[model samples]
Target: MDQYAVFGNPISHSKSPAIHTMFAKQTQQAMEYGVIEAPLDGFEKAVGEFIHRGGQGANVTLPFKQQAFALADQLSEAARLAEAVNTLSFNKGRIYGDNTDGKGLVADLKLQGVTLTDARILLLGAGGAARGVIAPLLSELPASIHVANRTEQRAVELAVQNPSSKLVASGLDNIEGEFDLVINASSASLAGSVPSIRGPLVADAVCYDMVYAATVTPFNLWARQQGASRTIDGLGMLVCQAAESFAIWRGVRPDVNPVMQFLRAQMTQSL
Candidate 1:
């Protein structure tokens, strides 16, 4: 069996193993997926050991994504643009890296019937999560994207990294105008809080939170309270991105709907 795993610092809570297992079963691929909790300072060593043990590929999470980018022998355009690598493949002596998060986000938005063409977008936060999805979002020809962060400089830096006339930057407090879509990529949702932005930004907009929980995420719930047209959590993005990584390793795509349904049921039951 081909061996694969997701690597991170605190990896016990990851759902990647279950998601990939379902993908493997659905695609009839003979592979094993698991998790590796690498020490903060020992990431490279851990990856080397996995490769030595015949590991085929691995998914990276959190702090390790940037490290994986530096370790790759070759990088896909998405990974290069994102400056992070969430998916990795090993063949012979070469390690190939790619970032599937943006593709996954765009795919999920399309699946949910959210229009991206020529829409005004508000992206909250300028962290890695925000960076990974900007390119894909821009590809859809959105009329404009305003990136807002607590630290205005960081958001401005992110906009400069991906220079486009359609993109702009601002501090959260300085955010202006209503958006057709509001995407929460900040860590506020993880703390059960919503980003500090005006309610009108989300009103009548499609609100998406890049954080998932058993119930609606804090950001999504807050968006709904502000009369958002629709609200979605990140579970679909997680599944879709994992499917992208699986396809990279197996050369076959697995149906995501059934897997998403199964995971949703599990989340509800746990609640």
Candidate 2:
């Protein structure tokens, strides 16, 4: 069987092994998927050894996405624009990288019954997670997109990275008015927290927290109390992104709704 895996530090909690395993069975592909605990300083070497052992592909997370971007012999257009790689494929002594996070997020929103065309979007965060999705988000041609970050400087810096559309950066404190969708791409929810921002950003908008939980995440919960239309966590995004990578490897697109439903049940049971 061909081997595939996800590489990261602090990977004991990852759901990828299970997600990919299920995809393999569903798609009837002969592949072995698992998780790899790559040392912070040893990402490249670990990947090198995996390829040597016939590893066919990898899903990267956290601190390694940029390094994976640097390691790829070639990158897809999305990867080049995001400057990050969450998916990888090996071929003929070369490694290829792709960023499926943005596509995943967009797909998740669609699964949640969202209509993205010509709508206002507020993206919270200016880091890699946020960067990976901006190009795809812009490609949808939202009426406007305002990126807000706690560190206003970083948000401003990132806003300049994608200059082709209706996008700009603002300090969270200065943000005013409403949006059609407010996506929390920040890692703040991992700490059981929400972004510190004024109330207007989320009011009347559907809230999307890129962090998922058995129950509504803190960000989504707070958005609910604020009278947001609806709230969705990141479980769907996770499944959608995984499907993208699976398609890249197997040339088959597995339906993610079933996979997402399963993961949701697992998260609920765990809690």
Q: Which one is best on TM-score?
A: 1
Considering only N, C-alpha and C atoms within 3 Å, which residue pairs clash in candidate 1? none
Q: What digit string (tens of lDDT, one per residue) describes model 1 on residues 178-221?
A: 89999999978778888899888889999999898889888888
lDDT of 2 at 271: 80
| TM-score for each candidate, following the candidate numbering | 0.98, 0.97
| Candidate 1's TM-score | 0.98
lDDT of 2 by residue, 75-167 (tens): 999999789999999999999999999999999888888878898999999988898899888887789888999889888888888885588
How displaced is residue 39 in candidate 2, in Å?
Answer: 1.3
